[model samples]
Target: MKSRRFMQPLTSPIHFHTAMIEQTPVAVFLGQEMIGSGKIVQITDYIVKIGNEFYVRDACTFKYAV
Candidate 1:
């Protein structure tokens, strides 16, 4: 007998523009690993401030966090 695996639905990346507008807490992930979590405090053209750390807006992925 063969085993079947379930696949998850694909989701879109959370853009900085949307995040800035929503102003919600997010989990910061580099690839599949979560590096940090915090609420967005500020945003610039190429950077985002989450808590006390600044990350290049495009270098990491952001997802809504509890």
Candidate 2:
């Protein structure tokens, strides 16, 4: 018989990078609500998503900026 182990996420919500359009509001969903109705801002920050599961990077490993 073989055994396997499953890893868990460090956080409940996951964040990712987003792009900004010209004179357009950012479109994203939080739970069931939509964010950014009529605000135009630079897309320098990352987009966060909530999920049941997530993955965490190792501390010993080096992370590259995408």
For all candidates in order, the CA lDDT equals 0.63, 0.24
On residues 1-66, what C-alpha lDDT tens digit does candidate 2 reach at each position? 321211111122121222123232223333444332332232222322222212122211111111
Q: Which stretch of 10 consecutive residues in model 1 shows the poorest summed lDDT?
A: 2-11
Clashing pairs in 2: none
Score every model by TM-score. 0.63, 0.26
The runs of at least 3 residues in candidate 1 whose Cα sits more than 4 Å from the true structure, single-residue gaps closed, are 1-23
Which portions of model 2 show Cα errors greater than 4 Å? 1-21, 45-66
User: What C-alpha lDDT, on a 0 to 100 scale, does residue 18 get in candidate 2?
Assistant: 23
Candidate 2 — worst ten consecutive residues by lDDT sum?
Answer: 57-66
User: Which of the numbered candidates is closest to the native, going by highest TM-score?
Assistant: 1
